[model samples]
Target: MATSARSQTQVYELRVYEIGFFRSADVLHTYFENALIPALNRQGAKNVGVFEEMGESLPKKVYLLIPHKDIVTFQDSERKLFDDETYLKDADPYLTADQATIPFNRISTSLVHSTKEFPELTVPNSAGIYELRIYESHNEGALKNKLRMFEDEFSIFADAGLNMVFYGKNIYGDHMPCLTYMLANTDLNDNKEGWSKFVNHPRLEEIDVHGGIQR
Candidate 1:
């Protein structure tokens, strides 16, 4: 919704993970809050975000985005950034000398191929609503974490009028025109009133939004 105000032509994604007896979210939290965002700004990135997996289907899921003008330039600069000495030094305290916190297990890289001709949607007044989306270059990929994300972890936003909606993807998109991401609409104006109501809410404790069944 935030990007609707401007024109976004290209996107580059970097997915991080700490799973399968390896990787650690603690490290990523530190890296992102400390080094990653700054590095991205230095490299000229737009619409950046930091996400956390609130569902149990997956463990330690965090994603980041960067808008670019051209795919080739994004890829080339990304390669250099990974090996940049400055980044390495800044990323040192949180990560091991060598990316030992998480190997290449869940790491992902993609150059988005937008839908053929995308249409602009009615960009809602999603003010104060935080939005995050994660995608891979495939037909039946994974995005299971969004379930707990909207249903519980951030449910207060909905009650407070934050208006939150989130969904997972199971289909492959065609190009720039295709709606590769799902619409997660939230009432952006939910104030602190909604936040206080979250304490010990029954649904907040239950992982399943619809009783034991997955919604």
Candidate 2:
């Protein structure tokens, strides 16, 4: 176990949604590099990462992890993003016309320490344990129950001795209809054994026992 895992820094999590039909993604990315990177640099942002779409059929989205001192500073800078002047200035004609890049709708949320960590498998070209999970609950008030069920599932995984590298969850900024998780894994027969135990638990049936929306 690489127990020396760094403390969870002040990470700002932003879900970015962009229209998928760009003529060429590379050009739009260059726009992002020229536009966003400098805007964020003006703020006190320490580090930033942007994860683009993985599978072919999905809409274009990016997950940003940036450092901030507190939510207040984050909010103040964010207001500028609403103004056309903030992202588009006369110096850049292509982006201002909104013709050169994809239009975006975004959502922002913080990643608390309680959230799960997913692995990156930094090794060279190796297939590692990674799973995309989607969660749904019928009852609007069933959040606690849902979390408990997740806890039960993780306990089973631990008993089986699987090492979970990374686990993170947040809804897509613009994509409704999905709540997702990124999982990192190594030696994951642990997952199979644990999940079987979790699904078989009798209490799971009682969770959100009343969340169906009638037509």
Candidate 3:
């Protein structure tokens, strides 16, 4: 857990929407781009990210990342959205759609608290390919050790040329005892190169052999 006061720390909401076959994602994209994101920004959340899967797969998935000031804001998000006339009007198409026209088959959401080292979400000035990774541990103790390992190795990520976006522990989600983080790179090659450096770094090797948590 972060040392920062819980009230002051930021929280993130990760949402995955599953789109069924033959369903168009157009409505979902429109709602996110034109309504949800704008409404969230107005309510103090920032750097809300929307992402799609890279390759063809059954039941395509869309990922939404929303950073909130704190848990209170997250808890009240639905009410705030519903109360906003502009949001309601702009989101009508998706919100009022019947089952046959619904954009997504289902939605899965997770809430995470920012880690002590990475307390806020950083949005790069230019767009790039983003990667989101989740690490799951078997138990709470192992999760704590994993977080500590990250805290100790934080600088190595940047040193290896990886753009660290945000790191957090899952506070409320399907996967228990897990941590998630995201990275951005110029492109696929850039991503591969950065991670290559990361994996081969001596510091990472030392941590893996000596300081890493057994999970």
Index of the highest-lDDT prediction: 3
lDDT per residue as tens, model 2, 28-106: 4565567765676667664455556556755565555444444566667666544546566622744454643544443
**What is candidate 1's CA lDDT for residue 15?**
51
Q: Superposing all C-alpha atoms, what RMSD in Å does each candidate have to the true structure?
A: 10.3, 7.8, 2.7
Please provide the root mean square deviation of candidate 2 (C-alpha atoms, Å). 7.8
Better of 1 and 3 by lDDT: 3
- TM-score of decoy 3: 0.93
- Model 1 regions lying over 4 Å from their true place: 1-8, 14-18, 21-24, 82-85, 98-100, 115-179, 187-215
What digit string (tens of lDDT, one per residue) describes model 3 on residues 116-207? 57787877655479999999998998898899888776778878767877788999988888999988878888889888988888888678
**TM-score list, all predictions:** 0.50, 0.49, 0.93
- In candidate 3 the C-alpha lDDT for residue 89 amounts to 97
The lDDT values for all models are: 0.47, 0.46, 0.85
Candidate 2 minimal-lDDT segment of 10 residues: 118-127
Q: Which candidate order results from sorting by lDDT in descending order?
A: 3, 1, 2
Candidate 3: residue 149 lDDT (0-100): 87
In candidate 2, which residue ranges exceed 4 Å CA deviation? 1-12, 38-47, 58-70, 79-97, 100-134, 151-180, 185-215
Worst 10 residues of 1 by lDDT: 114-123
